[model samples]
Target: MHDSCSSPQTCTKEQVVASAAPERTRPEEGHPLLEPVSAGEVRAEHVLRDTFGFAAFRPWQEEAIEAVLHGPGRVLVVAPTGGGKSLTYQVPALCLEGTTIVISPLVALMEDQCRALAARGIPATFLASTIEQGERNERERGLLAGAYKLVYLAPERLASEWLVNQLARIDVSLLAIDEAHCIAHWGHDFRPDYLRIGDLVARLKPKRVLACTATATPDVRREILERLGFTQGDYAEVLRGFARPNLHLHALRLQPCDQIADAQVVRAEV
Candidate 1:
């Protein structure tokens, strides 16, 4: 069941949680998250507070979110870890009319996010080899029935024609590629499967596409955008510099006896 509140601003966290569970079904609420926002109706503050329980968006997050909702659906967000990059697409996923598919690299990452979203009273799930076959079947059923707002999948999943065909049957509102820097050849951890994403986007033609990463050099950024089918006029790029003053680096070298003494001292302090 979706939240009864038609107005997102007035919607409560309780309402969000109550409507998020997949096991329950209700007649009043048409969807679990809430009714999709009408054109020009999505407000960043409303989504931040009501859906995500945040008072506001982070510095550059608001700009990226606004672009996804109002401007071109193609966006690239380059913000460091802990910068709320997930919220950029997650917020819009709730506001949009259909499911949002996030292409992630790691099963653990997908599972972690899915669990977090579920805890927040958001309908989110992930597909991976770790899931039991029976549970996977149930999730697939839920997906086709529009039970979730966000679904996380691995980039390699794009190689399956069966999966792609199944996805084509649904109304995919947003396609988010996390760790998008991996799409570029020069990226630190490049994957060949990522090269297939641009073609997948072309075939699915989801309403919007969001690429996110914490680290991407200028050349890598360009390569990523090009691979994701973003021409000059087709996308918006939100690049925020990474500057963490709190992080400090120090180095220490010690002989075996000195190291043992230091370890003993630390253990005694603990």
Candidate 2:
């Protein structure tokens, strides 16, 4: 990944076009959230209650949001599955100017998130191969027109010259990378396409970048930062303790068939 970043010869014309700062419509004319806020002013709590219908932030969520809303905007969040990782970036997306580009790996997850956001009257959309061509075209048009506050994209889509060019034409307020662990070569779920995300970051230069993952070891965490072009001391790290008091672990040493029988008995008891 460092090799690609250092060699300008490896960059394509499309990447250069994507990197060049294009003349964009003033953000004020776009999303209402694009309006500038005074320094030290925080709208995250309000957005949380009003937009997401949440009374308060989960542990470490507010800190992650603050990092994005304030200075040293690049962030890496490692939290458990139910630790409210989405809120860290989602709140800031509504607070900041321009669209938030979310790179999600699963089609189901993207569709579910977009649907949920739409139900809340938030302008969010996703680009995936499962959608019909007409719908995809319409979404692409909406993206270029700055009609959405949040847009979800698959990492593979970043390789498309046309899509990259279209994204370049818009203002990206924040870049949220979900399942960021995949970017680490040593991670259990590593995907080759994820490596291209580093290149995308270089091209888009979003105002802020937030990488979130439920699981990442120290080594995997280091790789994620390096691959995303975040150097030490340059970004904020939000690491949440992985303990869940409500969840209990029980071990049983038994044959596969006996284990199934025991599970059925436990289910019946419950």
Candidate 3:
């Protein structure tokens, strides 16, 4: 289940492994990689560290973020859960002078994300079933007032012609997709609404784009980029393997033990 409660517990080796299957992390706790020193424009170090609280981004986070931050087109990130995915585009969206539309799946998750960002003292909002017309108008006002740096919405909401008109007027800095793996033709339990995202991006005309997901196989990854119409050189794929090592290894041979069966049933119930 998706938890909006908090950053999970200090991930144990087993927990980390279980959560991220392929390998165990060193808990290299710190700010993500600071923006590289560059001429003319700021490297965005303060934003990376102060806003997001990372000493250095994982090997790929910085590269993917940079590709989107300063590039001809878009970037795709396939990272494990809690990989600081939201901040990748959120920080840049805030720094730039435009709105960023994040296409997310769950209404609850969207609200949770908007709440998390708001708690951090950021101007963020979401549109979903939870949003009433008054609140929706407020969100629109926020966007027109230049108060919202990032906005989250379910794909279905894009059907509103009025909303599309608003998008046409906004200087959208980025068009980002979360759970990007859903773009894959063979992705598990594909969401029908996801298939329209590429068209949505084209219409938004954002200066840049970023697609992110927690799980995707090689084939699935390819489909994500293709659906977005990203040329091979136009995007980068940043991925962390799927290997949850925290789970203890266990094996049992079924036996006619009434006590054992009772225990198994109880555990399943819980």
Candidate 4:
């Protein structure tokens, strides 16, 4: 149960990177009713129709959303980079009664996600190193006061006494681990903080849990499940494909080149 933000973090505060809504905004003044769909419905009709303005669900979003809304929930989505992993938990959080605690690997992702959720009329916030102790305390207090539906935090946040205490007081619906591959030592950017996740998740007592990753091989996927201690029957890996005919897999030794040109070249290719 997690959301993502899109700011590239620099071991510090996350920055905004989207078209933002005004602070403290709520559902529009007037709209047609978008009633609850079912007991298994994750995103309420209003979330799709009013908040996000999406008329229909995409691919497995509806199925994944339903799975989360139901109990005994754990999902592992191995979708590619653009498959909308964040929506799986965001929709469920919207339908649930409490917050979704998102475990993130990057500060920028948290900022981007929080901004998007905020714009969608979901009270979302983030915890980063930039805030002063006083402001940090205040934000924590405010969030625990039940003003927010989602909280974006780095995996390291779980190590803090303040975060632990604040989390204990809040009602959390889901615990979503984004870039879940980071939990593995074999991962390109292994993070020690990520290894502490399953324990932290048990402490939060969330109703559901979701671990997401954009790129994972068979071994990486197995390692991810083991790191999370997700039993064999506890989760499923939904893989779309492993082939990209357009890509030429090759290693190249390179010397430094113009940074701006390199970026421009890559962008043009995409």
Candidate with maximal TM-score: 2
Off by over 4 Å in 2: 1-42, 250-270
* TM-score between candidate 4 and the true structure: 0.72
> In model 1, which regions exceed 4 Å deviation?
1-42, 249-270
In candidate 3, how many clashes are counted? 22
Q: Which scores greater on TM-score, model 2 or model 4?
A: 2
Candidate order by TM-score, highest to lowest?
A: 2, 1, 3, 4
lDDT of 2 by residue, 1-270 (tens): 111223321221212333321123232331112123566554899999998898998657877776677645678888888778888877888887789999999999999888988999999999988889999999999999999999999988987889998888899889999999999988999988898888887787665789999989989988998888765224567788567888888776778869888988878976
* lDDT tens digits by residue: candidate 3, 1-270: 111212231111222223432122121331122232245543556677777677777656666666667542367776778767887788777666668889998888888888888887878888875678898998887777777889897887777778877877877777889988877778895777788787776576455778888888878877887787664223445565555566455555565767688678868965
Identify the superior model by TM-score, candidate 1 or candidate 4: 1
lDDT of 1 by residue, 66-117 (tens): 6677654568888878889999989988778789999999999999999989
As for model 3, its CA RMSD to the true structure in angstroms is 11.5
lDDT of 1: 0.77
Stretches of candidate 4 exceeding 4 Å from the true structure: 1-46, 242-270
